[model samples]
Target chain A: MSEIINSPLLWKGAVVTLQLTLYSAVLALILAFFFGLLGSSRHGWARAIGRFYVEFFRGLPALVLMFWFFYSLPLVGIRFETMVAGVLALGLNYGAYGAEVVRGSINAVPTAQYEATVALNMLPRQRMWRVLLPQAVPLMLPPFGNLLIELLKATAIVSLITISDLMFRAQQLRASTGKGTEVFLVVLVMYFVMAQILQLLIRYLERRSERILGRRPRRRAATAIAGTTGTGSLSGVGGEGS
Target chain B: MPSSDTMSEVPTPEDPQGAPMDKTAADGALPHGSTPGIRFEKVVKRFGDNIVLRELNFTVAPGERVTLIGPSGSGKTTILRLLMTLEKLDDGVIWIGDRPLWHMPRGDGLAPANEKHLHEMRKQVGMVFQQFNLFPNMNVLRNLIEGPVRVLGLSKDEAVERARELLDMVGLVDKIDAHPTQLSGGQQQRVAIARALAMQPKVLLLDEVTSALDPELVVGVQDLLRDIARASDLTLLCVTHEMHFAKDISDRVLMFDKGQIVEEGPPEQIFGEPTEQRTRDFLQAILAT
Candidate 1:
């Protein structure tokens, strides 16, 4: 247990794992927004292109994609480093899934919100940026959090591609120390810890968005305490008043 | 990505005629008791196989207050939606301030209006929905100021100042920083009204604005709207189930059934001395509940 905990090789592997997750996560997020917007675009060609990318990448398994990019592409004289290939595979794969999440979240914003923007005579760009995207973001957060955790777990597949990620280090430790159980348990705990951190980060973002959007009940609590603040009534003049 | 660049391709035949009218109808330029007149000529709208508005010919005078009353699915709300440019016209033309809405002039023929034309026409109109579609992502102040700041090109300070005035007019100045969810249904509706007014539109369309409010809350929104109507020369088109609100707000009441006007007259003639049996039936059916 002590050796597993103190192994410099394991620490190095963990650092590499963190780097891969961060880099690929960023890549996936950017592609998600790009393809997602295209998927929801009004243009026929843009939506078709978005659909093609999402379906093509999502149909292939991430490990197979890594192998193709790393091995098959080199045969055609188009080669990538092991880390680059792993990142591209993971990013493209998760990005396709994330694109669906983005599109769904944008659609989930009620039609009336769109109408409100139009009623205000907002340009299409203003409507999406100011009203649509801000509202869609909170809806996207929970699903995106799930995807992030999945991506963290999926990084283990990179170990098969000669990346010295945490799982790779664990395997080497198991072979040399002949203590598969101890080494694997430590690796499992490390993954769990990383997942928990991601969850915490996502939760913080969700709370912050709620605060900004006023979706949180903080104002309601305040309104209740302040009793007569919003109680102004218009009960006279027209017979329409209850 | 929707741009007005296509407008350059389409000849602005209405430009010569639309310019002067636009100047008078521009933000805060119209006289207190007059704005723009809306004319619909043979306008038709269909939802799938269901024809909603069939050869709908109607004209609203400048600063006139008109209420469209009909039973559910009579296409009363559809008329407001058309004017707001929320729904496309299946056939015919809609004129806002003497300019065609669904069509643009092109080489001695009417071409279907592009996104740019639709957007340009939209700025002249504002609408209040039954559900009070206030942007829940923004506070009352932000909601009121968003249109002015973004579309109207006012600075933040100027928009805020205008928003404060409008909120004070609607009596929600205290809740400027409060979220839509925190307010009551009536409060939210007021915010929606103020939000619409911040744009200073020439034509105001109210589509069942009070339908979603609590019974106790309906009066407040109605009262606020009544004050607004009396004070501004905005050409007002309203759709409502409330008979008294219809009577109070409308100078003329158009009773509709099956995509056509069954009867139209002063509120007194329509509600008190209805000439058409369908109008009486719709009134009785609405008032009974």
Candidate 2:
């Protein structure tokens, strides 16, 4: 375990894995929003296109998609670096799931909010950006946190595409040093720690969003409690004297 | 997209004389000296097989306070929805102060209104919904200021000044920073009223504005509305089941049944001596409850 941790090759591989996860996560988020809005559009054709993309990506396995992008695309004069191909495949696959999360969260916003926007005579753009999206964002975070962790774990498959991520480095170490048990155990612990940190970060974001969206009553209650504290001291003195 | 063809060809007439006077003269269909606050001409609306409103024709004169009373599913609320352009018309036209609400001029003819036309027409109207529809994401102050600042193009300071005045009027000056969920139902409805009034709409549609409030809270909301009706010349078209409220505020009361007006007259006459049997029976049924 100590040798594996100290090895430069494994450290380089860890950095590569981190880069892949970050790039793919951002791409997945953008696709999720785009497809989610398209799926919820009033036009049937837009909705159909969004649905087709979601089903196609979700039905195909992520590992197969990685291979298809890396291997098959070159035949059609389309090629990407192995890392880029891995990110694209992972992003597209997980984004399909994220789109469903976005769509469901947006729909869960109360109909009264839409009606209120209409009654105010706000333009459609104003309604969606200012009212609907802000309310939907908090609801979207928990599911998105789940998908993000899943995406982090799914990055393990990218080793098959020769991207030199953590799993890829672990396999090389196992082959050369014949220390399969120690190398695999370290890799497992690293992935679990990464997932735990990601969860803490997502939970922090969820709380911040809830505060901004006025879903949390903590601020109001804190103020009320402060107000009562001053009066309660005065009342306590009076009661003890009586 | 059918309306796209007319978009380029239709001249965007300048509102040189301002919206109110310009609207009446722009459309030459209305007879001289007959500028209605709202006009529904042969308007038809349906939901699948159920006809909500059928060839509904009515006019509320400028500054008139008109109330609609009817049983459930009698299409009273549909009238308010149509006027707000919340629902599209299946057939016919509606005019607000002589400007067609659902159509615009296109080369000596009328076509369905495009987005710009609809936005322009909607500026003249505001609605108070039964649910009080205050934005939960915004504080009471922001709720009142948002429309004026964004749509009316008021400066933030100017909008804040007006919002404060409105909050005072609604007796909720203390709730400027309170979120909607923190307020009582009565207080929320008051804020909704102030929010609509902040728009400075020439016409205000009330869709059972008091129905969602508790019985004790209903009186407070009703009283605020009564104060508003007495204070301004704002045209009001309200759908309500409150017979006493209808009697108090309406200059004219319309009784609707099965998507048509069964009877309409001065509130005193309609409440005291109805001429139609259906109107009498409906009134009796309501009064009993």
Candidate 3:
């Protein structure tokens, strides 16, 4: 524990790791959007091509893809920086899975919503932007929150690609100081705190969407109040509004 | 995913034309009413092997209240969908005022209009659904304001003010900030109708808008629609199984079965003195239920 306090490198490494996770998550989300849209389209060839992408990347292990991009792309004359390779590989791979989640949410929207849009004579883009996507957000939010947490965990893999992120620095300190237990223990607590914050974000989004789009779950206190008020009135008809 | 990017292919001339069209005798517009509401010309619609409309035709005069009644799959909803331009026609032409929708008259042939044409055509029509497809993400007030602000380009201040007025009309002024999920089926459907009215569409298409409502709530929705139909100049093309409401509000009732219009007349003649056996059978079946 004292070693972590003395090592400025460890703090900087934690910051770097957080940044990598943020960048990769954003990249993954953008790619997943188009992939999901294409995957959901009506054209046979278009959907087939999108399906191939979903299956190919989703089937590969995250570690395997990161290593392959880290080592193998030079063969194709595409030499990304280690940091870029790490983020891009993870983002693209997870994007494939995210696309399916997005598409599933889009499908879960009732056809009646679609028919209403049609009846409005809304343009195709208008129907998607105004009617469909808005509803899909509530459906997509919970699943996407899960993926974001996974991506945060995934940032740990970038250390293998030789990026000086938190985990990499943790490893370096472990080797130099031979305090494996202390280093990992500190990072584990840090991870637990990060996960707690991430869960708080998920809950906030869930509540916001529950208010905006999802089924209105009843609050127990409100129900209790109503029941008590009913019984009180029954017991005393003179119970006044005042 | 059930969703599809249905826009990809350039339609070829495998069929004479890809979409259908129906024509009405294009009456010169009344001096006061500049916009021709909706006219159909020999309109035919098919879903793959199933034909929903066949050589069908009807014209809705501006400010007319036309009720389309038929058994399930009688193409009533399909007609509303066609007017909304949600479904492409198999053949025939549809017109809104002087403009042709569904199919554009191309060089010696007809082509489905580009996305731009579709956008321009959408401005004049509004629809309310039976299932109440209010934007679940928006509160009642926002749901009313969204179309006016986004598609109509109304200022947000003006839109909110008008939204409040429309909410008042639907008798849900108290529920303006309520999320759609918080409203009952009746309340939500009423809001849906008001949202459509907020756009001030030249024609309003109501597709079985009350059929999905609970029995207790149906009357409330029907009363709201009746008020609108009585008060406004908006032409209405309503597909409904509510025979009593349809009879009371409709100027003319079009009775349909299979893929064709079996009979159409003033509501009294069609509902009371039916000339077609199919129309009579439909009325009996619905009334019994």
Candidate 4:
């Protein structure tokens, strides 16, 4: 483990792996929001296009996409760096799943919120940014966190494109030292540690989002109000104004 | 039909001077002379095959406070929804001030309003929902100031000042910085009221505004609404099941059934001596429960 940590090549590979994950994750997040909102659009054509994109990418394996972009694309005169190809493939692949998460979360925002914004005379853009998205974000975070971890593990596939990520370095070390078990074990632990760190970061973000949305602990006054007002019967009627 | 005063300007289908029968008036000219605060002429609405409103015709004079009372699914709330432009009219037109709410002047005819036209017309009206749909993402202060700052083009300081005054009016000045979920349902409704008022709309639509409150909390919101009704000359069109509140706040009370107005009269006459058997039956059933 110590030797693996000390190896300059391994460190370089680890850095590349982290960079790939970070870049691709960001790209995937952007695509997720774009396609997710498109999927939920009121226009049938927009929804159909979004659906086609999501299904096309999600249906193909991530490795095949990487290979196609890296190898086959150059044959068609569309060349890209190995890292760029890897990032694009991963981003597009995971983004398909992420779009579904986003679409569901946005839909989960209560219809009343939409009505409230309309009643306020807010434009569609203003309503989405200020009212709808803020409420939907907290619900999206957990699923997003899961996807991030999966994408981190999926970075291993980039090694097939000749990118020297952590998995590629581990394979090289195993071939040179003939110590397959130790090398693979070290690589596995490293990946586990990275995933754990991501989990903690995502958990912190979820809590922060909850705090911002006032979905955390109820204030004493609110609880007291609830107590005085009673439950079920009283609160049920309370929404009559909607 | 209970009183001539309430029935005075109710338009008939053949009333030529009512909504222009000519669908081809594309001059973009604002109608001249005194227009009622709101007028619904032969307005028809439907949800697929389920018709919600049928040939609805009514006029609320400027500053009139009208309350609609009806059984569940009687389309009272639909009326408020239509006035707020939350629902589309299947046929006919809604007039606000001197302009049509659902149509804009095209080259030689009226066209269904686009987003730009709807945004412009929405400025003249505001609504308070039954659910107290305050933006939970913002605090009480931000909620109150959002429309004034964004829509009304008020500076931050001016908007904040106006918000503070409204919060005070709603008797929730202390909750200015608190998040919406931290307030009681009644408190939230008050904030919603103050939020609507912040827009400075000429007309306010209240859709069962007090219906969602705890029975105990109902009075507080009702009293707040009463104060607002008395203090402002803003035209109010409300849908509610609260008889006493309708009696106290409404100049005119309209009893609706299915999708049409069964009877309408002054609050005294409507509640005291409803002419329609349907109206009396509804009043009896509601008051009994």
The residue pairs that clash in candidate 1, if any, are none
lDDT tens digits by residue: candidate 1, B1-289: 1122231132212222222222221224222433778887888899999999888777777777889998889899999998888888999888887789989999998899998999888878989999999898888888988899888899999999888877777888899999898899999998898888888888999999999988999998997787777667688899998989998887888888888888777788999999888888888888888
* Candidate 4 residue lDDT tens string, A25-113: 99999999999989988789989988988999999999999999999999999999999999999999999999999889989999988
Pick by DockQ: 3 or 4, better one: 4
Off by over 4 Å in 4: A1-11, A41-49, A218-242, B1-8, B11-36
lDDT of 4 at A67: 94
lDDT of 2 by residue, B190-281 (tens): 99999998887888899999999999999889977876775666778999999999987878888888777777777899999998888888
The Cα error of candidate 4 at residue B287, in Å, is: 1.4
Number of backbone collisions per candidate: 0, 0, 16, 9
| Per-residue error (Å), model 1, residue A205 | 1.3
Please, what is the whole-model Cα lDDT of each candidate in the order they appear? 0.84, 0.82, 0.76, 0.83
Q: DockQ score of candidate 2?
A: 0.32
**Per-residue error at A90 for model 2, in Å?**
1.3
In terms of lDDT, model 1 sits at: 0.84
Question: Candidate 2 chain B TM?
Answer: 0.87
Better structure of 2 and 4 per DockQ: 4
Give the C-alpha lDDT of model 4.
0.83
Compute each candidate's TM-score over C-alphas. 0.89, 0.85, 0.78, 0.87
Worst 10 residues of 3 chain B by lDDT: B23-32
Clashes of 3: 16
i-RMSD per candidate, Å: 3.8, 5.9, 5.2, 3.1
TM-score of 4: 0.87
